[model samples]
Target: MKIYSLINEFSSLDPCVFTLGIFDGVHIGHQKIIKNLILRSRKKYCSVLLTFHPHPKEILNTNKKFFYLNTLSERIYNLKKTGIEHLIVHPFTTNFSKLRTKDFLKKILHPKSKIRKIITGYDSIIGKNRDSSYEELKKISHKYGIKVYKVNPYKFQKKIVSSTHIRESLLLGNIQWANRALGYFYTLSGNVIEGKGIGKMINFPTANLQIDSKKLIPKQGVYAVKINYLNNMYLGMLNIGINPTLEKENRKIKIEVHIFDFFENIYGKKIDILMIRIIREEKKFNSIQELKKQICMDKINIQKFFSCEKKIR
Candidate 1:
């Protein structure tokens, strides 16, 4: 996919079928629009996925904190897998947000991508004060000689698949619901960094992770996870929290993974940890032996989860 950063690169005037959104998790609902865009593309019309950086909320200076399911890089990573032809990542800012619906349509939306058709959800809107509506979009699209297609809500597990719901599910440690809505496991990917080697002393050596600060971390707990290290998939258990059992001066949250039966000098290597399910909440154990016993139980439970999931498959 060709990535055009609207902040630094000149916009492409290629005529294409396009859709626009922040697409936080690019959950099942967002994927529906993307899938349609790709399907709609033909010899005459190419597919374009347009999104924004800093997210609109940050630009709007909203009171709500921006907690996205995927970081910008992660979003790009997932979008690339969808086989889209082109992507335009417009930088969202206060000035950019000032563009009213019509101005946005005329200046950025139409002219830059020369969109022949737009594929988006019925409730989707972009611009100041969430100003655009499906009805309004249809009107302007006609004037611009463009076709507008609204995709219905994509539902999973009886509820509409959405980024907000996915984030909520993850925060609540409802991994099954979140993963179902996401159409894939939510992942924490980053470099493995040096750690205090406390896990090694306890015979449960772990890889300390340095993840993106902006990425929305799931609730603090122990989880069953799958890790991809240099193309090898490993069954793993990870803890996401400051080890309450340890009396460390800095009680900052940490992500530590223990890949079952795998041992290697993985420090400085990048790895992707996919959250499968939350096993238990982080707790302060009375002794090191108690912590070890809990970890052993976590391992057993994770193996069971994988075994049951395989049987279901």
Candidate 2:
């Protein structure tokens, strides 16, 4: 897929079918809309996806903590897998947010432009103050001769699948529900960094990860996960929390993973952690021995879990 940092950089004159959104996780709901877009564009038109960088929430919700399900690069990577021909990641700023619904449509969907159709989720709204609904969009786009299509909400277990719901699930450590909504495992990618070597002392050395602050972290807990390093997958257990047993004075959250039966130096290397299931919530232990004992049990249970998962597959 070809990616452009700005809408103006996309100079293709070929008529295109496009959809625009933050598309943070590219979850099932977003996938359904994109699928419709690609189907509508097949052979006759190019399939285009337009997303915003830094997310609109980051710019507008200045007083609230806004965490993104995927970083800009991760979102691009996920979108590429859906067979989009072109992606426009427009820079979002205060000025851009001020564009009224009609003016925004005129700029991007003018009668002279090549964008022929737009596919969007059923509930999607845009423009200043999010005042434009699907009905409003259709009315405005009619003047520009652009067609509009709305994909019904995608649902799993009777609940609507959405990025917001997935984020809530992750924050609550509801991995199964989140994964079901996403249609894939929730992933966190970062570089390995030096740590206090406390895991090593317990015979379960870990690779400390330095993740982007803007990326949403799951609830503080120990979890069963799969690690991707150098394109190889390994079973592992990850802990996302402060080490209360070892560091009484420190309260900063830490993310560390111990790959079973693997002991290669990976400091400074990047790895992707795919969350599978939550094991247990992080807590303070009475002593180092107590913490080590609990971790041993965690490894055993996680191994069994993977074994059963393999059998089910």
Candidate 3:
């Protein structure tokens, strides 16, 4: 598969099957659209997946703001696994956001990229202020002689799957539900950094990490997590909150992971943590003894969670 960051740089002359969207999480909902695009492309044209960078809201400075499930790097990594033939990550700018539906179709989709067909979600919209809808896309397609297909809703159990639904679930500490929609564990990757040596004194050593500012942080809680580093995966427990019991002043939010049965010099190493389940909400203890006791119990609970090998249903 080939990736293009600039439209002017693309020299591919083939007419291709195309789809365009933010595709935030590349969740199950977005996956269905990509799957359809691939299935349709195999028979005739090269598949093209066009997405945006920096998010449109960042450029438009809209009042409606959102936290993303995956960063641009994460999205590109996930897309490469989908067996697509071509991927275009177009930079979103204020000037591009101002294009009307008609001009966008004529200038970008039709001539520049040679879109033979466009696939999108059922509720997808484009153009300024989201003025374009499924109907508008169909109307414009007729003038350009391009085919348009709207992917049907994807569902887990009985509820419809959406990026918004997944974000809400994560923010509320529902990792299992959000991971179900994601088709994988919700993950964060960062460099392990030095932290106050509180965990060490308590017999539980932790590796502190600094995550991206643009990334969406899960709800403040203790969770069962899996750590991936040095090409190995280890079961771990993570705490995502200010260390209330350890710090009474100038508290700072942090993510610390205690890897079980593992000891090595990992400071400055990049690690990826995948949240599997929430063990408990974060709380302050009256004494250090209570906090240490609760942590011991949490380790047992995480072991049980892994022992049962509860896979998403």
Candidate 3 structure, TM-score to reference: 0.93
lDDT of 2: 0.90
lDDT of 2 by residue, 212-282 (tens): 99999999999999999999999999999998888878888899999988989999999999999999999
Candidate ranking under TM-score, highest first, comes to 2, 3, 1
**Tens-digit per-residue lDDT, 1-313, candidate 3:** 7999975566558878888888888888888999999987786888988788878766676776656789888999888888888888988888887887666665555545577788888776667646555666788776678888888899897889988789899999999999989988899999999998888899899999999887889999999999999889999999999988888885778999999999897999999999998999999999999999999999999998898885632
Going through the candidates in order, what is the number of backbone clashes in each?
A: 0, 0, 0
What are the Cα lDDT values of the candidates?
0.85, 0.90, 0.85
Q: Between prediction 2 and prediction 3, which has the larger lDDT? A: 2
Runs with alpha carbons beyond 4 Å of true place in candidate 2: none
- Candidate of highest TM-score: 2
Best-to-worst order by lDDT is 2, 3, 1
Q: What digit string (tens of lDDT, one per residue) describes model 1 on residues 34-125?
A: 98998888677888887888887765758877778899988998999998988889888888888777667666445344778888775676
Q: Which regions in candidate 1 have their CA more than 4 angstroms from the true location? A: 7-14, 62-64, 109-113, 129-132
**Between which residue pairs do clashes occur in model 1?**
none
Model 3 residue runs over 4 Å out of place are 61-66, 111-113, 129-131, 310-313
